[model samples]
Target chain A: MSKKNALQTVPCESCPLRKLDTLREFDEDELAFVKTFKHGELTIGPGAPIVMEESNSPHLYTVLQGLAFRYKTLPDGRRQILNYAMPGDLVGLQSSVFDAMNHGVEALTDMLLCVFPRDRLWSLYTKRPSLAFDVTWLAAREEQLLDEHLLTVGRRTALERVAFVIWHLYRRGRSVGLVTANKIVLPLTQQHLADTLGLSLVHTNKTLKKLRATGCIAWADRVLEIRDQDKLLEIAQMEDTEEARRPFI
Target chain B: MSKKNALQTVPCESCPLRKLDTLREFDEDELAFVKTFKHGELTIGPGAPIVMEESNSPHLYTVLQGLAFRYKTLPDGRRQILNYAMPGDLVGLQSSVFDAMNHGVEALTDMLLCVFPRDRLWSLYTKRPSLAFDVTWLAAREEQLLDEHLLTVGRRTALERVAFVIWHLYRRGRSVGLVTANKIVLPLTQQHLADTLGLSLVHTNKTLKKLRATGCIAWADRVLEIRDQDKLLEIAQMEDTEEARRPFI
Candidate 1:
């Protein structure tokens, strides 16, 4: 099946998560209990706001297809992308900490999302502590990602930062079976990449040009294709650990 | 007893942690069981390395006196200070994830630390699941701090970043009863401050000079004193929230 069709096949009752090894730790009854959760799909077009700032809506979302970026806008209208979410990844996990979101989430492309109500999730956690633990673990992982991003923003060079991001996206794609060898398609704009890296648009474009000039990567048709994976990885200064790779698969 | 004298009174058998309200959530037997494990204290001098990189010694430490910086150094000798640990704070909680430290921790002053072996702590967790949950919660709290730091590094200016650091240190000091109404002492050096903020030493000094000129804060002789906290808070762009303050108290 095509990627789009495969994602559409994902339903609340027949979610592939039930068969995943990560959920194998849950017993038959626990699985059935979670399966009872209500699910709804949200399709967000490019540049559309998925979760608005200060919105008290308490639905937790999981990315089913396409990509989304979470960001906060400054008073001057500049944006800072806090994180990027991909398929099978959970977003809005921190919403549990507050009554409303302090940041906004926007779809980077036409996307699909599976959402669950916070109240129902809390009730499920109360009955199955293991599920709660899993949720907490997911939050912890997000925290780790934030820490790594801090290091990148604070210390890495512009080229290194861009390479790190591309390497990261490539690794995530590889794990989700969207990548073949070192080549992967990245559907992000230079402006969005700059926001995520905390760099200016001009600097981001310059860095990408350098990467392409050095025969490191190719960017065309809004898709990024890594050419020299080893050279790019070295420039990115990424630690080749299993944990650094995506966890979805 | 004065705070300094309180430091010398090492009543391992009667540590206040046994009576802490958070631990009270555990049963009496569990408290006694945890207390039976001997606590060892280690003193580290300024610039002394406390934890080595990539060495997997499994022991969790609690700061009893003085200060330390958690950092990861790159091959080129660029260091990023992840966070600072003060009295009553737990360090090395990430040791649960591996056998060796991915980062190195060093003493910023002559420091005293209370050590708990990983095996003993793991045993305690097995016996009391609540204890494990509490540790996880602490880890989660650490993650939140990292997230805030990420935001600081990603978007905030050099001056704003320093102000945020000072504000955070002052708030932490107040939470642990180390601060009075309007004054707090910061134990970090400008050089260390630069490392933490990912700025050059000269830039950090320039920022400090600016804050000093504005009479927002004062730093000398390794002590940072907040002069006008309201102004500093405003400059730091800190949100006034109960959750931003420590919840343990």
Candidate 2:
């Protein structure tokens, strides 16, 4: 499928993410430049490839709707999910800088992405330091999440891993308005969980069953509901850091 | 202990890392700007911290010499070593961008770090898009390494984890001129390995014994020697990617 869209549509000032307190605001000139810089938006269906690995694309993206994930595959076809991309999360920033994607991004649900030209990124960096810094902040936030995931996969027990990942997703989803009250929809399967948590499918189901038995979480109809958020955090042994206002561009 | 150093002694043009093929070279103008932007150098002894979690330091760092590791600690004292920093590695880019360090960096050996003012980072972004791009590149590289570590931790078998980490360190060290032929000084203890690999000390020792029995590796006297590099890579099921010239700052 063609990754490029026909034309620019969304004006930066009225962008949906501007209403969220979670993201930092852009000044007038910055917004105008971004509006011009944004080429268009592209939508993909579930299980669609947004950015393929090893293919050099001259564009970067930001998630405008739905969910997707970044992942890598071994030579023997073993896949590992790196992290999920939610609304307002910048996609392909690493690829834009490094000039090659070491991993690929695939949509979990139907996804809409804001497209920006990779060639103009240098202009953004030179003319808009705040925006450039925001990009760095986003990359750093991603790195922090990966560090946490690495620890969870490497050190945490099976039960703790399940609890921790659920809590992590819940918090991030809530921050981005994907979660309302105690419920959030996750377009993931047992296979996704197994790959993400580094467990066998059987083990993932068993651990998830154990978590369900605690009455702290309910997962059904692709929606996960937190019945006892405190208990889950306690089980996970995690304290959420107070994240500052992040930038979405 | 203080994480501060007294004065700036080295000029940017005379920076030792510029001599290495591993790092990208800066033009004269960029070099002059960086020399003025740099605040000073700090010497940290083994086991001392370079950046502490939650502390707002006004400076970023680049490793000039020796080794260090970044990590996070649980409230109950569980520690997970995220990744190592060798010569020519940018140390505090994440923290400088995000404002609060989500993890801590500690020296694995006596180390020297070139300190740069965090406030002037915007200057680099505005005046030197290339350097700003390089900073993002460094952060992206770090994220990529973390991705690999996550996959190793979450998916690889115990023996594979052991084999992979050793190969990882050996390759990274070689790129930065820290390795000589088959030998590399790690400056890490068994406990460090246990923490880093998410294994117990006993398990770590046993795994090392198994690796040594294969006639592919030797670890003793704080130094690791590779015996058959190809055999180790085969055991790890890995291929080393050819890394391009990296930016040290």
Candidate 3:
């Protein structure tokens, strides 16, 4: 991509961040400082590791295109995906606090990222306290989402959990204008969804079948189409209130 | 207890956190400003809810004494404890971005809290940017801990998960000078522990027995005493890196 196109594809404008007002409130000079960031792409086939476990070097990555999964492997070789990073989603915010990553991130497709050097970002935060505040708010928001994930893994039934995950992803995609009312490009397999949800592959398959039977969602050609958005929300136990879909700061 | 005695009981002077230098960097006026905070108590007897789901309250709470857990109840009556908040820990920091809470916090003991209203805190941040930095750093540290917990729940076995939880609690207690090297007080019961770890009660019980049999921990009088910290860490697959223990800023 040309430099101009690369800058346009940075996904910053479309990010549904809760604290965009704070970011936009930045002075021209401050915005210019952030605008200096460069972007890059990594052409990795399926199953290529994007970030390794216990690595000292860390870089903040914002997805420009394609999919990636953050996961860790147990001693017995079982893997659990922490989450999936999609377009406009930023990763490595936690790595900013820690010196090393405890888990690994692997690309499930050829990926593109707007990469920021960790030290430079830290320097920016030191010079621009407002940026630091924005970053902190973003991390706090991530924590809130993790809290919800803990609930899904701990209490929700396999079907409810799966429904919840799908609904969450759909809502997030919709917020970024990546999805319509009923259609979303899921791009994740039953196994990938299973790993993310902490469920067995068979269980994930069964849950998807159940949802399909109920006309809550349909799966074909690597896309998930929500057949009944209202019913899906009810199954996920999500409120129609603004609170349920509020953007994280 | 007298105010002075209560402050003494907190052992602020002896805290490793005091050696972190962040607080020491504060000027006299800043120190005096924070010292002016009045200590208070929040009592919610066992099973009393502290923060309810879908309720909007703009306050951040610092635990003064006692234990509390954040949880969400499912439609089928299943509950998952998202986290256990201890003394000196923060609760509801992320809720400031939202108009309502998606999860509920309830006391395991009659809880005591140092409540900071969000508006007042934000005003303070505007005036004393450095204090805001410190508070944001503290919130970031909590996010790091939550990330580690996510790894444990997503990847580790039931036995390893329980062991890691206990080990983490022990380490946190040590950081706060609440425990010695080998002895620690565990205030939560196995059932409560099970809920937090996303394990069945029977599975949690079996795991505890296994740990006891391995001579890594001893459970008596509702307390878990670590006999071999190294062995416990090994079983938990935890890295003993300084970064893991440090309060990240």
RMSD of each: 5.7, 2.5, 4.8
Candidate 3 CAPRI classification by DockQ: acceptable
Q: What is the per-residue lDDT of model 1 for residues B1-249, given as tens digits with 9 covering 90 to 100?
A: 143334545655455443433233335665565554334667789889888777776677877677788887666777788878877667775554444567778888888777767666655444545444455556656655776676677778899889988888777666555676556666677888898898999999999899889998877875668888789878877764443422210
TM-score per prediction, in order, is: 0.82, 0.95, 0.82
For residues B200-232, what per-residue lDDT tens digits would candidate 2 score against the true structure?
889988898898899999988988999998899
DockQ of 2: 0.68
Which consecutive 10 residues in model 2 chain A have the weakest lDDT in total? A1-10
Model 1 lDDT, residue B185, Cα: 63
* DockQ, 0 to 1 scale, candidate 3: 0.45
Calculate each model's fnat, 2 decimals.
0.28, 0.63, 0.41
Most DockQ-accurate candidate: 2
Rank by lDDT, highest first.
2, 1, 3
Residue-wise C-alpha lDDT for candidate 2, range A1-249, written one tens digit per residue: 133434545556778888888888888888877876787888899999988877877779988889998998777878889999998998888778877988889999998789888888878888788788788888888998998898888778999999998998889898888888789999799999989988899999999999999999999999999999889998998876655778878
lDDT of residue B32 for candidate 1: 62
Clashes of each: 3, 0, 0
How would you encode candidate 1's per-residue C-alpha lDDT over A1-249 as one tens digit per residue? Answer: 133334454654466444433333446766666555545567779889888876766777877678888887655566777777877677765555445577788888888787766667656554555555555456656655665677787888999999988887777666555676666667788888898888999999998888889898887886678888889878988766554322221
Kindly indicate the candidate among 1 and 2 with the higher DockQ.
2
Q: Write the per-residue lDDT of candidate 3 for residues B158-227, one digit (tens) a residue.
A: 8889888888887776665667656877768888888888888898999889888999889898677888
Q: Return the top candidate by TM-score.
A: 2
Residue A50's lDDT in candidate 2: 89
Instruction: Summing lDDT over every window of 10 consecutive residues in candidate 3 chain B, give the lowest-scoring window.
Output: B240-249
